[model samples]
Target: MSRKLLIDIHTHLYLPRYAQLLRARSQIPRITTLNGEERLVILAGEAATGRPVGPSYWDRDAKLRFMDTHGIAISIVSPANPWLDFLPPAPALQTCEALNSDLEEYCATSPEVELGGRRRKRLYGMGYLPVVPGQEVGGVCAAVEALGKLPHIKGVILGTQGLGKGLDDPALLPMWESIAKAGLVVFLHPHYGMPPEVWGAQENGHVLPLALGFPFETTTAVARLILTGILDKLPALKLLLAHSGGALPVLSSRLASCIAHDPVAASRLAHDARYYLGRMWYDAVAYGPEELAFVVPTRGTDRLLCGTDHPFFPPLKGEEMWMSVTENLDAVENAPGWSEGEKEGVRGGNAVELFGL
Candidate 1:
């Protein structure tokens, strides 16, 4: 059988308009110039501090080129991290509206440009929500409702922070309910990797944070959601966890053991831990075949989807295939006990079915 049609479900973009906004801001996570070098300072790190911001991040044409080069037939785009999370209420709401509308238009109306005599497939996007601005729950609900009306928008991409106090906050239930009602999948991506102090003084760059800290944050967020019975409460809500559920596949047994040992916590759990784990979906971003093999069976092939994390982990100097992308593809190819059909499901078919693409 032909290799499954590849879909990059986790690719990111900083739309030209959004890139302008980032450039205008003077912040640690925003773009900055030091010593005649324009750097995209997303996070403080020792490994080159962060590369300069460029067209690859914001230009729509660049995205299509990358997709074509990588043999990706479809991409589900979302705004990269630090998404409207730092803005205050009024501006945050406006920014979210503009960005969502811009993204919706880009994905829905943008014309396909031909590459190698074949036209590129149209892209799909996940809308953004202004959760940090303390927008009224009603307004937040309205935003989600609006996303459902857009043809190209299949879901909303979110960070671990819900409302203000992480995903476990009770105040987020109404928002969750609204999203569930709207049938918008929640693509839960991580931003605030552990607290900075946890990395130690000697650590100087994004390597540890991006590689290790991110997964930990995702794991913690999902754990909080599970512990609070959020999954059971919002049964219809579909969630896709980035970085393959952030180590949940391997650490789930330990989490269950911990909960089981605690009589009070275990008593409060509305359902078995595994039930919640089985309910959510994961992306195939693990770096090695063993890691993918370990995570896929635990989450089930149906729940796994492919992701490239584009515009983030670009190929290292002089490399042809990006280590980030190849590792994930290799993992899917080598996962044990899964048939080629099952592997195809994890690679792309699952996403196409789940996202209705």
Candidate 2:
């Protein structure tokens, strides 16, 4: 049997300029040396959470090699979390332009990798814009306009916090309008999880933050967007939710029940909470067949896209093949109640159609 065409829609890369900028800073999102190795510190309470930084996070050759080894035909790469979120508007705008340009160059020039005996691997760029706190709406729109003109840029990846107001603020109307007008898809990812206070004083590593907080952050942000009628207002906007809509699909019924019990919350949207679940696209990063099974019913298979967070979720067993990547593939391939054609769609067909890859 021939191998299926695979496209990874959720991978990330930090261009050299962005990495250098982080290396020179002293703040939380900065890079610091620990035991002669560069490590990325991205949160305020990151004293014990920083991961070792390496070439895979920013090198083009390293990314292509990984794609070849994994049989990924095309990878849509984007700037990872907390992306220019900490910078002031002027430098943030300039940094965004440089970062997008660098990403565009890599996607346009990356060598074709041999996959399944066919040299078919390629990379596509997802540009960044100056969406940060305290920036003037007009300045952010200017950045959006610049990104739209970049030929190789297919879309953008954004942190849950939209201009630090958490995506529900009316101040974001202009930026959303600009991206919608540009025909760019929004890859909504989570960077800032729930408050540290919610985690308590457990020294349990990243399980709490990664397993619980991250999904809740995305769930809350999207809920805010839905309740504020922003999703309804922007009908043409396309959003791809990271981490399988981040607990939103599973917890949707509970949210809808709560809204029903309260007139104020129920009055916020013209439609029910369940409507938004069907409105957005979801990535198959949930890690198990049963999880994908549940997600299929919530959003349908046509909306599913495959992703391997790469470089972020490395194999801990020192194996060349990442369990993070293979496990998700296994889940999608074996997910119950999905037809063969639907399985192929979840793997890469949806991404190809959604991003024009």
What TM-score, to 2 decimals, does candidate 1 have?
0.93
Model 2 accuracy (lDDT, Cα): 0.84
Q: After superposition, how far is residue 276 of candidate 2 from its true place, in Å?
A: 1.5
63-171 per-residue lDDT for model 1 (tens digits): 8888878787788998898787877877877888888999988897766644334665469899888888476767778788888888889999999877788888888
Q: Which stretches of candidate 2 lie over 4 Å from their true place?
A: 1-3, 112-121
TM-score of each: 0.93, 0.94
Instruction: Specify the highest-TM-score model's number.
Output: 2
For model 1, the stretches where C-alpha displacement exceeds 4 angstroms are 44-48, 111-121
lDDT (Cα) of model 1: 0.81
lDDT of 2 at 183: 85
Which lDDT tens digits does candidate 2 get at residues 213-299?
Answer: 888888988888888877777887888999998888888889888888889988777777887778889999999998887677757
Q: Measured by TM-score, how close is model 2 to the native structure?
A: 0.94
